[model samples]
Structure formats: C-alpha cells, structure tokens
Target: MASDTNELFPIPAYCKTIVGSEDGTIEDSPLQKLEISNPARILQLCEGLTDRTTKKLEIKINKYLQAETDASSVFMINLLTVSEEAMVQVVGDNILETSIRTPLSEDTISDIVEYKDNSLKCAEKLDPKLQTLINEIVTKDTGDLNIVPIVAKERRANIPKKTIVSPVYLVCFVNSSKDNRYITTLVHETFKYCLALLLNTRECEEERRLKQQCQSLLAVARKLFSHLGDLNDLLKEIMSEARRLTNAERCSLFLLDPDHMHLVAKVFDGMSPAEKNTEVRIAKDQGIAGHVAATGTILNIKNAYKHPLFYKGIDEATGFKTRNILCFPIRDEDTIVGVAQLCNKMDGHFDYFDEQVANAFSIYCGISIMHSLVYKRIQDAQARSQLSNELMMYHMQVSDQDVADVVTCPNSHDLPNFESFSFVPRRVFHRETPCFVLEMFERLDLIDHFRIKRDTLARFILYARKGYRDVPYHNWQHAFSVAHFAFLCLRNFQLVEKGYLSKLEALAYLISCLCHDIDHRGTTNAFQQQSNSVLASLYSSEGSVMERHHLSQTICTLNTEGCNFLESLSREDYIKCLDLIKNMILATDLAIHYKLHSRQLAMAQEGFTRSNPEHRYYLCSLLMTCADLSDQTKDWPETKKVAQLIYTEFFMQGDLERKMGKQPVDMMNREKASIPDHQLEFLTECCICIFRILSTIFPSAKTLVDSITRNIIAWESSKNVFDKLRVEGCTSYDVLISEELERQVQATLECMQDP
Candidate 1:
C-alpha cells in the first residue's frame, strides 16, 4: 500500500527492507529495472514519410524534355506561377495524362506575395542586365525551366562567384533532346547514378549522427553510474550533459522535492556561487518546467520573453539573459520524475536533433536521480549514526558519576527570590545554578507530582546545559536564564493551579526553555542557511533549523543513559510531552513568534478558554516567547549587558558573513547597525505586540510588560547618545555600544545605590 505522507510516494516500505535487497528491488537499493549493469537505449519513435515525389518528378521531367512542348496534350504538362520579382515554374508529374492542370492567373502573383516580398526587395537592387533578362521572361510569358540557367548567369553579372542558384527543378535534369535544350547536356544513365549517390550520402550522414548520439549516451551512462556520491554533484553532471547535448549556454535541473511536493531547482550551470547555493521552488504547474512536467510535452521556445509563461524574475535575480528555452520532462517508467530546462542555444533555436538528444538525456537523468536518492538515504543514515556517536563521545562525555553530587536538590532556604520575575541568574554563584534549577522542579512539585526521578532530572539538566555551546548570548547561561523565567511564571502566575496550564504543560515549558538553545553556534537561522551548516541542511526545509536542533538535542539527552526523565510518564503523556516540547522550543524562534503574533493577540482579546486547544497552544506559545526574551525585561544594567552579549554575537556572525562575501542584514551588520535604534524597533515592532498580548491575558504579567516598557525608554535615550557619538567620529558602533554599555551599567548601579 502506498503511504500518502511518504516523501517518495510509493516507496513506503523502503526503509523496512533496506538491507541488501528484497526480491532484488529494495527501495533503498539501485532499481532492478534500471539495470545498473546495462546501458540504456533511447526508444526509437516512428519514422516519418519521405518526400519521394521528387523521384517521380525526375522521371516525368526526363519524358517532357525528350518529347515536344505540350507533349501531353490532354493536360498542361508545365505550369508557371509568376510574382512581380520572380517567376517560378512547377508541374505535378504525379498526375496521369488525362488529368487537367489549373491555369495560373494574374491574381496568383499577389496570392504568393509572402514568398516574393524578400525576393522583390532584393531584385530591386539587381544590375541592369539581370533586370532586362527578368523583364524579357515576363514579356514573352515563357518562364520555362530551361531559361533558368540564362536568368541566373545574367543575375550574377554583379557578383558571379558569390551567387549560386539552388535547382529544385533542374539538379538532376538530363537533357538528351538536342533541338531546343540548353540547360543540360548529360546522357540518360548518368543522372540515375548521381541521384543514387545523393541518396547514399544523406543516409550515411544520418547514420553517423545517430552513432555519435549513441556513443555520447553510452559514455554519459557510465559516468552517472561510476560517480562516487553527493546528489548536488550528480545534478551538476546532469546539467553539464544537458547543456553539452543541447549546445546551450546554460542549463538547470528541477526535481520533485518529495517533502514539499513541488519542483526545486537543485543545481544550475552558469550561475554565481550564492545563486547556485540558493534553492528555488516552483509548483509542478507554474513555470516552463512546470508546463513540461504538468503536460508531459516539450516546449521549444524561440523568444523566451514573448512567451506567456516566461517570467524575468529568475533572469533578473541571477543576472542571466534568456533568449530562448527548451524544456522537457524526465520520466521513470510511467512516472514523470522531474524536468530539464535548456536556455540560449549556441547557433539557433533548438531543432529536431537537439530535442531528440535532450529527450534521450532525460532518461539518464531519471535513472541517475533514482540511484542518487537511494545512495543518499543509505549514506545519510550511516553519517547521522556515526556523527551522533562521535558527537556524544566528544560533547557529552559526562556521566551519572559526574553529575551525582550536583543532582541532589539544594535546600529551599538557600534559594531565595526564585519566584521573582526580576530574578537575574548572573548574580548567583555559578556552581549553584544547576541545584537552583533542580529546586525549581522541587518547588513545582514536578519532582514529586510527576514522579520525575531526582537523579535523572539532574542529569537531564547537566546534559542540556552541556548541550549549549559557549556562545556569547545563546550559551548555557542564556538557556538557564530562560528556564528560570519560565519557572517564575509557573510559580507566580499560578497558571497550573488556576487551570490555565496543566502540570505536563508546565513540565514541557520548563524543559523546552532549558534546552532551546542547546548546541547553538552563536549564529542566527539565516547565518546557518548562508553558511550551509549541517544543521541547516538537516532542518532548513522544515525551517527553524537551530531551534529544531535544540529540540533534537533535548530528545537525544532524554534518551541518553540515566537521563530518560520523561520515561516515568505513560506513553500518551510522553508523546504529548514531546509534542509540547517541540512546539514550545520552536516558539522561541522569533520568526515564528512574529508570524503567530496576530493570532495570539486576537485570542487574548477574545478571552482564553482552558478547553480550547487553540487557546491553550496560543497561550503556551505566548508564555514561551515571553520567557525567551525575558532578558529584555531585566533592570537597565542587566538589559544593557544582555544587549551587549546579543549584539556581540550578531556582529561576530556579520564579520563571518562579510568574509564569505555575503551582506548580513542591517541588524547583523556591526558597522551599519545602530544598536539602540534596532533594539527600539525590535521592542516596539516585534516584541511589544506579544508582550502586550500577554499582559492583556494575565494582568499580573503586566509587571513583566512594565519592565520591558521601561527598558524601551532607556533604549530611546541610548539612541540619542549613540547618534551624538557617531557625529563625533565613531565609525564602528557595536564596539562603541559595548564600551558605553559597561560604563552605563556601572553608572546605573551607583545611582541606584545612592537612591
């Protein structure tokens, strides 16, 4: 049975029978029908009917010359169609002697104006001698086939060697009649052999062309099979071959992104590095490739701009001008797998020969894609396993023995001000933070209420803390701070007791906060994508790459030995717990928060219902975001300090992006970023809407909102101060902000002491 949700559509059981082969056709192995051991052949389409009417004409023309004019008196043996510039004589020798020919009229000249227009323009520039000859033929009304040689000789008096007339009528004329014949002096049998030679030469040329195509196909097949790995590399090879086969200036390959059910351009030839790295997705019914994939027909475009479906966005973005295009579908058996597009043929528009090669080339692409996809699955599984084991060995070497001492909950007396929204973990003894985290669980009665084993809970914290990289802002300290804020809300907001949140919800919320920044690399999601990090490659399609990795790390820690904190819960509760954890963790991604802001606000305005799942999700999402940005609600000094840490990380990423020749966003660019103004924008635009929404829901949470509102003022003041500094020759601002932030922290602390 096909799994509708499976990315590979019909390959639902692929991973089940992945080892070696099952019936020699395991989905994770090379396709048996593909015959990796054999070369593929392009199926020959039906041969077209040749124009053998010319052969029969060769016979009749010979008879007419041997006999007199009007030889077949029952019918007109010769007919002439005259234009203003040229006279064309044609006769259908296919008709029997009794058949009558239609006589040419004066109106016939205007009927063929399209064929004569260019010829008429050129004839106007002809020399006097050719003009006289053309006039004589028209005056005498004797534009016969024999007079063509005289007309051509007169026409070429201007440029004799450069002009040679093609003879559709006289190329094989063998005039044995000596009375009035002047066109040819050849004997009867000689013409037959010349025609035979012409036929043989055309056949040989066609044979050689097909043989070349076969050789090219054979070589490309071997290359696709022998290539080592990497889907991008295989696609580039496909693009190169497509371009070579089509003689095109550029080529691109669009494949079905099984996940999105859309065509994504995986690789492009003749593109810049950044453009190549960028992924472009279009519907299977949207663009040129879309047309081909949707209809299963080739579109050979002469002028791309004039085509209805052609859009200039891609050309403008990539700095490539598209004059022409030839797009065709790639198929595997009955399934149309993808599309190959060729642009700008070197000589002219893609003709029949190029289309045939491209059609055959698409077969190679489809088979290679199948092989590459299967190989990638096998390699990804092995790499993830090896990387996980290696990452565990390298990053998470701590064990039960190491965390056993810290696993014991601290006495509650030693942990004061724990439920305050204004609590700053930076002031606490660094070594006692883990115990305080445990006591958070203890206070929530999570340790007792949910039957969370104390030692396992402690180990989970240590693993999560270890999971965070030592970055400036999103390190262990930041994760702990975020977790502390969530604990305060759970303890002070009385959400769980008031039925606004369940114990499981609170547990998921706290755990989500604790692990949300795990394994962070001090970079934004955009940075991860720009740099093409492993995390981005893994989760970028689903989006929120860093946040998703944090969640993955949380799961990895929970499953680690002695750290299955959620294992005590029932299966249903465990699944729900992880689901909430995933949602809450992803909610910390500000991008998601910005998207959900309007929904959160509307729900808050509409009133929260504990029974409404949407209400619960929006409320929980709101709480998670508020907790993540809790540092912003701290007192002035801590707010400035945290701002320094964040901007420091942002600027560092900006420097790295600059080194890679990519322009960072305004807020990330250290030199251009006005710290105070950016923060004010963030606070006013992106942050305040959600915080205000939170305030509307829980009136007591207004204290959290109040703190942010005050800090917004200080940022407004700092903007003025920074502007003055820049006027006085401050070139780089984040550094100036860093220096001024430390000074302001001390000054604010002193003022508070004096008060």
Candidate 2:
C-alpha cells in the first residue's frame, strides 16, 4: 500500500497476488464476462477486496471492467458480484444460490481462529525486537522518528480457546500514545512511514550531491598542491572554496590565536570596501556559532534571534545581520584546528538538509584549513630563504677583486704596461697550517704601531697556538679557512703558472692571509659600540669592526717580518693585492651588503679579466670570502661543526652584549638553541651563495661546491625537532654547550701543544 503524507509522497509497489482467482492470473477474472455491475454490486466488491491489495486488482479490473470509475478505483467494486454473474452462466441458475447462501463450516472457522491466534503470539514476541532494530537503523540519521506497526486481533465462533490469539498488522498510522487522536494517529503514522521512504530516496540523492562536492574539493586540493610554491594563492583558494560550499552570502575565516582561545579574522568574502580592515573577534564560547566552534560540534540555528546563545551586539557593530546560521568546528583529529561559520544560509533557514550539507563540507573545511596553513608556512620560509641568498650573492659581488675589475689603482695602472707583467716568484706561506702565520707574528714589535701586541694580535696568536682540533666549520673556522684559501690563490698564481711565480706576489698573498684577523673580537658590527670594544672607537664606524681589525692586523704583521711583503712588491702589485685582500676580508662582515653587490656587478661587466693582476686580485678576494663560507658547502659532520662554532661565536658575543644590557645579536641572544631545521635552512642559503659565486669566478670548483650543497640537504632530512617548551633544545642560540665539554676540548688542544 502507498502511504501518503504532506511533506512526503510514497509510490506503491506492485502487489504479488490477484484478489479472487485461484490461479492469481488476470485471464481467470470472473469480472471478464460480467454484463451489468450495478453500483451497489461494485461497492460490495470494493469492500470484499483487501485494502492492502490495490495495485494488482487495478491491473485486473482494468482488463475486464468497463466502468465509469477511474481505472484505479474501478477495482474497488465487490469482487463477489463479478464472480457470481460469470459463474451463473457456466453452472446454470444454481451458482447464485450457492454463492449467496452457502454457510461457512464451524471447523473451517475454528481453524482460521487457531491460525490467527498463533500468528498473533509470534508477532507480539517479535514486535519489540523489530522496533529496536528499526531504531538502530535510524539512529545515525537525525530526521528519523520511531515508527510502530498497528496490530489488530480477530476471533471466530468455531475456534478452540487458547492462551495466544491471532493478530493481524494493518501497517497504518504510527501512534505516539494509546490515546492519540485516531485521525491524527492515522496521519502521523502514515506520514511518518511516507517520510521514512522519502528519506531513503533523499539520502541517495544527498550522497550523490556530496560525492560531487567532494570531487570538486579534491580537484581544488590537487590544484593547490601543485602550487606548493605559491602559498598565498593556495590560501586564497581554500578561503574561496569554503565560501562556495557553504552557500553563504558572505563568509570569513579566522586564524586561531597562538593561545587557541580566540580567533583573529585573516580573510573574508562579501566585505564592503570600507570594512576591509575591520577585525572580527569572538570568544570561544560567545554565540550560536561560537558555541559550535568552542565545542567542536555543529550548530544549526533556523532563527538566530530566538536562540539564547545568539548575541546581536556583533551584528549591530558590523552591520551584518544574522538570520540563519550553520556552523561546524574545523578539527584535525581530537584537536580543534579552527572554527568555520556559514551565516545567513541562502535558503533562509537551517534544516536537517542544511545540517547534512554542512557536515559534509566541514570535513573539507578542516582539511583545507590544515593544508592552507601548512602551505602559507612553506611559502614564508621559501621567501626568507630567497632573500637570504640574494643578500649573500650581493655580498659576493662587492669583494675587493670585484672592485679592481671596475676601478684601476689611483697611480699603479700608469707604472708599467708590459706585454706580460713580471709576476713574482712565490714562497709558500704557513706551510704546516695557515695558523703558522699567527705564530710568526708572535715575534713582531707592535709598539711601533702604537699597539700592545701581547694585548691584541699576540693574544689572538696565543689563542690559535693552543692548537687546532677540528672545531666545526663555523665563523672561527670560516675565518681561518679564508686565510688559508687566500694563500692558495697567491701560490697558484705565483708558483703553478709558467713564468708566473714572483717573490713580491707570494709576499702579497701570504701577508694578506696572516694579518687578516690582527685585532679580532668575538662580535658582529652592531655590538662594537655597545660593548665599548676598542675597534669601535678606532674605526669610528667608518667600516665594520671586523674589517678594521683585519687591516690593523695586517699592518702589525708587517713590523715582525724580516722582509715586508709590501716592500718586496712593485708599487702596482703591492697596491693591487692590498686593495684586493682588504675588500675580500671586509666582505665577511655581512654589513657591507650594498658595497658587495656593486662590486660584483662591476666584475660581471669586466668579463674574464683574470689575466689582469688587478682582476686576479679581485677574484682572489672573492675566493677568500667563499672559503670563509665554505662550511655551508661541507659534509654533514663538518657542517655540523661549523654550525656549532658559528653558534658559539654568536653566543659569546651575545652574552657580552647581554651582560652590558644591550640586545643580543641576531638569534644568539635567545636563551635556547635554534632548531636544526632552521639552522639547516640557514646553511642551505649559504651554500647557494657559495655555489653561485664559484660558478662565476672559479667554475672548476663546481663539483666541490655541489658536494657541499648535497650534504646540507641530507642534514636537513635528518633534522632534530624540539618542543617549544624544551628550553635546552636547539631552537635558539644561547643554549650552552656544556662547560665541561668545552674544557675537555680545550684540554685536548693543550696536550697537543705541549707535545
């Protein structure tokens, strides 16, 4: 039987059996031969036919009857009238009497009663279980209501008395209570049943709709993933999709505060031109939307004003009305990732349908929010990396060698123009190790230069004499490497080349490296004034503290050497290498970034001017800077050491500044070590700078540069992660690397020095 209700319509299923024919085939219908079926006779047939069996009879009656009634209602007439009239013709006049007057036997009645009694007993036993099963099936669907079957009992005169009675279910109205108004009960049950059927259909449709939405979302996700590079675009896509799915007239997404208790709106749709900068903030527990957000649940309000939790103050301030709201908390697992609100549903009211739609969307919202957040982070990180690299390249460009390519010496260019300059015969400087030059300076008379050698340069030399134990390649090693590498360039130019070796040239390169750190201090340019370092006053901020130190150190190394490299060189060669080394060492300060960039551009314009002594000096200066940053291109173990050394130098400087009540320099002033990932990121940029510069000046070194770059990437792969709370973790620079370990390292060096 088809159930009918206001909100839902049920379509009838075909009945399995015919009403009267024993064969249950329409060809055997008695009504086929019926001549005049009077209205009264039709009414009788209608009453005789089971109300539950209509679709089949309709088909049968439509075949045999020519009635004024609609084809569907034509089957409502009495079946007996059709049967009797047709039977009378076949069996003579006796059929009428037999059909009308035949009495049912008591035994037959008794058997019917017995069967009914047994059926009722079993049905009664199954009803509760059946209801339970129905409830289970509908529990997940919010629209489902409890539906109970209608059961009736029948008794016959010949039936034997029994404990159980036969019960028949009419499958009529779902009754809320025994006293439910009969008409309303019928309506409610029929309506409820119809709704259940409709719901099944609706669910199928809804699933299809949701599946399509998911496909769309997945497509958007795939597109955004491809733009892994453009995070801003990715975030924009996510916000746009959120608005589209909610059918919201306007929507906005907020970033959670670091504390996670409040939300700060970051992006929006449907904002007035004037409201672009407007901030919307709500507490975790504030309104219908906020409650859903706070509890990580869905909140649907058909009428926002009627809800106790709805606050109108925000609407008043923002000039946006809240009519209907569908909100769901965006969650990544048990953690609430964010809260999303779809306000003023385009349909004007939030319903069960809205809930289903929103619930489906919430899943995408949560994932999209997570994905977008990650995308933005990666974008920010990459931008920072690019900027750092650009700066490093800029520095490489301005090295001393770079300057020589553009600007000739004040008077040296006029000294001599030979077919080929008589290049100096070279002597190897610091044969055992580059640090030997510092020891050689131990015998210099620094008093002539108005300096106390023992207090300054000699102290530095003494420190280096403590011995080299493979300290990681950090700033200190970078400085030492630069010194050694400068020597290599000088030796290569002077000794390796045919007729290239020159005494003057060798002195120029060796002395340049030796005096590179004469007045060295363990701080950056910014800290010089704050710590009242002597170099700060001496240089008067004309140049970086480190650069000033390098020049001073070179001048002092001169007072000690038996033959000054400066005196040995021709005036032209002397000025060229001197200018070259000065600019190269200065590039290490990182403060002269603009200067470095300008010089590199000049070098580029000059093309391959390596054969020019001045140009060779320019290139040599650049090579030294490269060596200083070489750790960035080193193997993991070597790079790790450099990171440690750089960190230590930064911390030592930061400590001094902090003690003096100044801001700590860069990342070092913090009270913890920096995360390895960030450190590795820093190294990666450094590598790019080295590789880029080498590609330009010393293309032969590309293989070596590439190896270092590979190691940095590998180190990043095995990075160490630290909790924000763990103070000792390597996410900051101030974290101490155990005093005992430092002492042991120093002790090891002392033993080596004694032997």
- lDDT string, candidate 1, 526-617, tens digits: 88888887776667767998888888888988998988988889999999999999999999888888788888889989999999999999
Q: How far is 123's C-alpha from truth in model 1 (Å)?
A: 36
Model 2 stretches with alpha carbons more than 4 Å out: 1-480, 487-507, 561-580, 598-606, 611-618, 670-678, 722-755
User: How much lDDT does candidate 2 score?
Assistant: 0.45
Instruction: Estimate the TM-score for candidate 2.
Output: 0.33
TM-score of candidate 1 relative to the true fold: 0.59
Q: Indicate the worst ten consecutive residues by lDDT in candidate 2.
A: 85-94
* Native RMSD of candidate 2 (Å): 26.2
TM-score per candidate? 0.59, 0.33
Off by over 4 Å in 1: 1-210, 222-240, 243-252, 266-337, 341-360, 370-396, 401-410, 413-417, 442-452, 491-506, 523-545, 568-580, 591-621, 644-682, 715-755
| Model 1 worst lDDT window (10 residues) | 37-46
Shift in Å, residue 186, candidate 2: 99
| Tens digits of lDDT, candidate 2, 226-262 | 6554434554565666567666676656555547577
